[model samples]
Target: MDLLILGIVVLIYFLLTGYVGYVAWRRTETSEDYMVADRKAHPYIMAMSYGATFISTAAIVGFGGMAGVFGMGILWLVFLNILVGIFIAFVFFGKRTRKMGHNMSALTFPEFIGRRFRSRFLQYFGGAIIFLGMPLYASVVLIGAARFLETTVKIDFGIAFILIALIVAVYVVMGGIKGVMYTDALQGTIMFLGMIFLVVSTYYILGGVVEAHQALTGISNLIPAEAKAVGATGWTSMPVYGSPYWWTLLSTIILGVGVGVLAQPQLIVRFMTVKSNRELNRGVLIGALFIFVMTWSAYVVGALSNVYFFRKAGMIAVEAAGGNADKTIPVFINSAMPEWFSYIFMLTLLSAAMSTLSSQFHVQGTSIGRDVYETIMRRKGDRSVLITRVGIIIAILIAVVLGYILPGSIIAQGTALFFGICAASFLSVYAAALFWKRATREGAIAGMVSGALVSLFWLLFEYKKTAMALGVTRVIFGGPVISSMPWPVVDPILVGVPVSALMLVVVSLMTEPPSREHLDKCFNGIKGV
Candidate 1:
């Protein structure tokens, strides 16, 4: 009975999100509308879209899984999430992006940077990196949401992933950012409601908030020797200082997402959609409040799930879930919630995925359509728009296929890896473009190339399959094969982000700045003349 109700809820979510897509399609007058909603997004819509892009299934699902293993310390990421992601992004980056975007008349990130520095190479280079990198991130989010749906609804993983991807792709291709923003507003609402319910109901099921904490903390000794031998401690307790787990959390997961947000092409562009700094400022509180609740709840509840699993199954939940780090959050949700919640939970998961997926699909599609195929590839301007449409179709197909890749790049991702790469790779030039008056075209090129290549090089070397083939766990980091590190999860952001930033700053300093004339033109829109 409960399953049937949940199915209907899932059906309704698809219908509503699809409707937003339809609205975008019907209203769109040109390719510009399709790519950036003609750059007329209001304050409220922009804020929600920005929020949607930030908090996806990764936060609730991927991070939740991490919290299950790492405990509550991951909550510090929530603070960075809002401060850097919402406040700094909107206040600092958002204003400049919108102002300079208009000044340059640039529609995409690549175009914005390309036109700003008066270099087509930067445009193509930027687009190429985004095109190559975004799919991995989108795929990670896809897998996170799909895994949840497959478990809760008993749907096949392949079918669920493809269907969700198709639905989001259609809307994105049809409506562009306008469609994405509108849909994000709706999806963001669902995310808020769904996360709150999961948290509240879990608390109720555990008899109360106080009792849940007490139960989780009391079983300190239940932590396994394997866990203690490395870094695992009770969820209610902190990991040992300087432990591998702490470094991974502080450096990779936390720093990766927190610091990496400034460079995300898709999210960075949202700041350009709004009207003014006042609008961006208004969104700060709302964005922060929503993120705090959604993420904080997921981590706290994930930590407390050990108690729930212990009482019901006589073992820690991770043990019950087969010690697969990814399965921890799923086990908690399935074991803790009643069947009715699955229906709503499915909505939460889908909402999370679509919010991010739509942005990725659109950004990737437009890069092909507008940036590469048209601008750099030398297609005529009018013809390039047509190619962009075709590119959208192609990009969608690529994402759909990649959705089924099983995220083998690491233990699991679905799409999270791409986000890290995107942030680490692009955030530097992006930051320099806005904040540094001395940014140069030569510096931009070097920074982007160095940042992206260095990032991918690090990942390949660190997790080289050749090492695994030779009976080693890591190729570059080099250690034992069978034993776990104090930190089990290895995120790519920590390695990649700082290198990208360093490359950008150093290269910019080495080269002459963009001509003074260009700086004056770029800053023409600064308020009050």
Candidate 2:
């Protein structure tokens, strides 16, 4: 790689991104504009921004590498991402969220829920959860970007981490959601084009799509003994039923991320950014296609890299990257792709990373500042925006520090962990707040608290992977997990969401329903919707 050429290309990309941020910053005149883009974003910008923020470096680098290790079975997540994340989300959740948010004059997700239920407690609790849990997700995204730069550009990981964090933090602190979404549109375009080129070039390099699939399918014997023990089948097949691999893939990766996306603070807020259902309807096809190309291409190219690695080095993708699935895609690209293509792909990863990170930082900021601080202080104005800027900087610092501290091959695990927690803690209450007019504030509180507790308990005592990582169970119970086999492997979302939903429904029916006037206000303009 030519240092001067790389520098010039990166400089141009930064300048373009900075220009977009500057425009957004200039247009932002109030907290509403900063927090929700003034609720009048274009369909194209909303769709692309949502998709870009949804599919981050976590998808391409983290989960893409997991596809290399787990095989094409991980492709199921792509299907669910389109169906649940985009289709159901836009059609069911997005439209209602938009109307209700507007009705409540809510600028943030927590604020939406809070105002809907007439509970300041809900607002602050929700905001506190996002402020605390989001850093883990943000940190993994930072790691994915830093890892790519270190692998492809030979930049020091520390330097790359600081540069990426600083760039995203600056724009997010200044431009707010407007800045975040504008740059997301630009970054999303780069990611889409790059992934198209990646998948096409990968197939061309390996003979053809069919040949590549066949080549990958023929290497079942290459599965390591340990993997086979855990029910590894092949790159083309799903893991065997009841096996640890099966449990982790189905419950953790596929279901956790797929279902969890619906309640994501950063993503849910995108629905509030648009003005009406018309924009969301127009955005459906665009968001779905963007997610399909970005995710499908990553998984396909990731799985096929096995064939390339096996043929060239007599090793599978994971082995080629020395047992670190997180490095699989990076190693494959740098070693197999043309020199010029590597530069283009580098920007693709950077776009994916920055777009998502900006959203994360912005949401985290709003959670602590707009939701928590304003609710507590009983105030909202310029101070909310200023406090949000300070919160963004703090979020960036925590994420950068975690990016350095976390262990290797943690990209996918960390992503799944955070997504699962979000789904468990917020999904049930969020859904009820949107769709269930009979739901009481007490019920919502019960659901939220129960869901969060169950999720925290599962992470520390039942889910073996996270339990072992945190060492809470090990220290307290003298083992990594309290339960046996399947319970240890099962995801927190499975148990927590159900418990939460059950509590909400049962408690709501037993308690006094919300006032008719409040329900009328929330459902006003959402009757047919």
Error of 1 at 81 (Å): 0.5
Candidate 1's C-alpha runs over 4 A off are 1-4, 380-382, 407-416, 463-492, 527-529
Best by TM-score: 2
* Candidate 2: tens digits of C-alpha lDDT, residues 454-525: 999999899987788889998898988997888999999999999999998899999999999988888888
Model 1 scores a TM of 0.91
Look at candidate 2 and tell me the lDDT of residue 246. 98
Error of 1 at 467 (Å): 6.9
- Among all windows of 10 consecutive residues in model 2, the one with the lowest summed lDDT is 520-529
> How much is the lDDT of residue 103 in candidate 2?
92
Model 1 is weakest, by summed lDDT over 10 consecutive residues, at: 407-416
Q: Cα deviation in Å at residue 210, candidate 1?
A: 2.5
